[model samples]
Target: MNLLINVFLLSVFFPYITVIKSLDTQPTALFLGTVLFLIYFKAEKKQNRYIFYILILSILSIFLFEKSNIMMSIRGILNYWSLGIISYVSYELFKRNKIKNSIIKRSINAWFILGFIQTFYSKYFFKFLIVGMRTSDDRGVTSFATEPTFYGIICIFFGILVIENFKKNDCILFFSNLLIQILFFSKSSMVVLFLLIWISLYILKNISLKAILFSSTSLVSFHFIIINFLKDTRVYKLYIKSSDLKKLFFEDHSLNMRLSHIFYSLKGALQNFLLPNGLTQWIEYVRIETLQKTYFHTLTPTTSARIMSGFGGIIYESGLIGIIFIGIIFFCLKKGLKNKEIAIFIIIISFSAIQPSFPLNGFILGMSIFNLEKRRIHKNEKIKSNDCCRN
Candidate 1:
């Protein structure tokens, strides 16, 4: 049973099979929802049971208030609940020592193997994995993911898992992730954001003038290397596009779309008194907000036009409730992590970058659980040491 659960947990993000065009549905939701729904009947912990309760409340909220688009709201419920289950299962696996070290090693190996296969046969694999979604014609290696940027995001998950599990013998996995980000994905923003947080934490741990100077120098050198050598990469292109404000706003459809999410989501939330508009209504809100704009015709009404920013989606969907949800999430993360600042930094960086999607959300929470359990054990050991010394 544990092995089966582990397999499902690991494969949650495995090249999602889209079911609905507008909603961007993944089949894993159905599998997860069915399995976890049954398991909830036998759950012992209130923490586990509360998930279903929340799901029920969310469904009720949709029925009660979501008159504009109830079906979309239901889709949202299933998607989020399944994601919540992924997190729950991940927390359970790590907490109970069900996720073996060997499993982690094998999963990382499988990631590389799939990446290799996809690299050589990009067109074939892309069509097989993704359907009815927007994609870049000149995208670099996407592995088993739908797109290059998403592949980078997926790599972030594996990177976190590798760092958490193999502290000593992680050089291969470390560089492999880096290669995937830079050479394969041709996008380094994810890596840069992660490294910045990591370096910031390291400096905070060992605060000194020399440490600050060294980090600053290293960052500058890294930037210089990227600008000079990696001109073809997506981040570099985006950077180049940032020079002209007018061009950046109008010409860069990608940037413009992302900006619209931020601008309109905030505007809509302000007008709605910080209350949730409705589930899956974010794209509609974006549509309504941008319809008057000159560039409205250029934007699609499909899921591709949905909010790319996770934090923005949260605010746009739930408003003040979203803010409270974030607070609770990070508060728990802070309690679990040794360095609460990492949690804070992750939240800040993820504001504009991370997309709010299935399995990704759950995978992150599961990773947080890993750190949380690690911290708890270390804290217990310290308390025990203090008690023994006093005695």
Candidate 2:
């Protein structure tokens, strides 16, 4: 089980999969991992029984509704069913093996090295460029991914692993981590935001109130510096021209594209709460003026027309039912979390609100870490009670 789990992790984190397009419809990691794990470890049957059945039934519902659109069904399977099962399997396997500090550190190193290699390869050999970002923009390194944002997400997850090891306070590793983000030119704001959260938490934990005050003041001043500096950059050119708050958010090309999709998704969710269209579903049933703009679709994964509705996509794709399933999993994970673990969750969620899909990798990592903390706290409490009885 441990060896298979490691291979599964490699398939997810490594750049071995040559066919990126197949990922849209196939469960590359999930399918392969399931086969490997099934060969060795008997699948956990007791706890996951109800959820597994529910998941299977929900997937079959799509086939009943529309058999012609098998592609969308495939997308639904890979995204919802396969990802859910495989992630849990990863979590369980991780627990069974007693996930170690060494394993976490080694995984972080793999993510960083694989990311760097894939970025250069994508830029020079594959030319996997996004719509708004240009070839010379220096932000076009997507690694093995078809999009830079996804690459950014992978980097951000690695950053979380680094934070797990951040207690060491390695200055060189810290700077190098930041440098990697700069090279990737990942559009996702998670890199900076996550780093800030780590720094803030570390200070609050280890440093004095005076140091916290100093850091807070520095961050506030840095905000001003960034505002002034960004107004001059190409990315914020539209912001400089538009003084009106409405125009600033609604008219900007980059911002508005995402904003429009989010709006469409919300409206669609309200209108089609029970049977919302899954991914790649562009049915004419949805009648909204704004949603028409989201219709453009090419075969490529990073195409400008890809359905990117942040949380809205969840509601739009599987309706309230899907949201309920996710909520159940979330609350279940939360039951074992400690106060510090909850604080860490708030940080990841802040970025998750804007990301196209739920940050599942981050969720899995957080839950596993929190479970470990819960056990440690339990053991400490038991020890204290034993000492009191002895006294």
Candidate 3:
């Protein structure tokens, strides 16, 4: 409950903070400080090799760069890494019985409920809170993202939660979340939602000609009903413009812009392939003043570019050796994908392309997937052992 409340407050009030900023440094600092204090007082074995390595890498990277901006960027990266550590630790705590699954479920429910209400307030009620708050541009939309992309990502997460819960037969939770996502009217989100649903159906072996026909008919009917009833409203207009059927596969300027941006990012990556710099430096060189400006002007770099930039920064600071080591780590991770941890690591990397950078959310998600894989492995091993004993 406490964790959920904290997340809700952060989401509602500090929406501008990137997930790394919110989940990594602050929470990690507090957690570590308390743990250290406890260790000192109780004479507990406070050994955490991962945390030690993370801290050392972060500090060493800062000194290696010796550039204030690069150091700052490294700090940001460390913050994000810290969040991942925190999430993993939290998951471990749950796995070790320090926390209950029921608690986690309840927390998730609370978060969804809070998110739904806050989004509603932002859409409807917040206008009258302040004199200048009612402007169309400022009226309760994502203040953090310069464009709607971030909201789209959030919608994707929400949609994932909805689908996952729905598969578990939590219909009310699923529908509630779906409604919230619909209200956001994000094109990227709609596309992701469709993809997720389709993939899930395929995975479940529930996809069929009849199912497809029924889904198509239902979607078309829903579209007609929406257009007939809400055509004149702003929400309707936004929905029509952002709908997956209309924008993703049909015609949409925003989608075109994103496609173009992807090209530019790839170009940038190729140009800076050997000597990548940090994203902050690239932004500075590009004279991108703010998040909104960068997004609106299509100046945001691509995921490949960003990773290359980070690699480049390392090279600049620590030379080819550092880059080589990092590359090796990545290579090993790729090679080990059959291992659950590696698969989760890959998903985290893939998700980073869609998100701004690797943040707490990505970290937690990676850890969760990794843990799930571990559990499956354990169960499989147990089953095999049992079968052998019986034989």
lDDT of 3: 0.41
Error of 2 at 241 (Å): 6.9
Could you report the Cα RMSD, in angstroms, for every candidate shown? 4.3, 6.3, 8.2
lDDT of 2 by residue, 59-99 (tens): 54354245666666555455554545454555555546544
Q: Which stretches of candidate 1 lie over 4 Å from their true place?
A: 13-25, 33-37, 45-67, 117-126, 129-137, 186-233, 243-246, 280-284, 291-305, 338-341, 353-356, 370-391
Measured against the true structure, the TM-scores of the candidates, in listed sequence, are: 0.78, 0.67, 0.54
- Full-model lDDT for every candidate: 0.59, 0.49, 0.41
Specify the poorest-scoring 10-residue window by lDDT in model 3.
Answer: 126-135
lDDT of 1 at 92: 61
Best by TM-score: 1
TM-score of candidate 3 relative to the true fold: 0.54
Worst 10 residues of 1 by lDDT: 49-58
* TM-score of model number 1: 0.78
Candidate 2, position 333, lDDT:
43
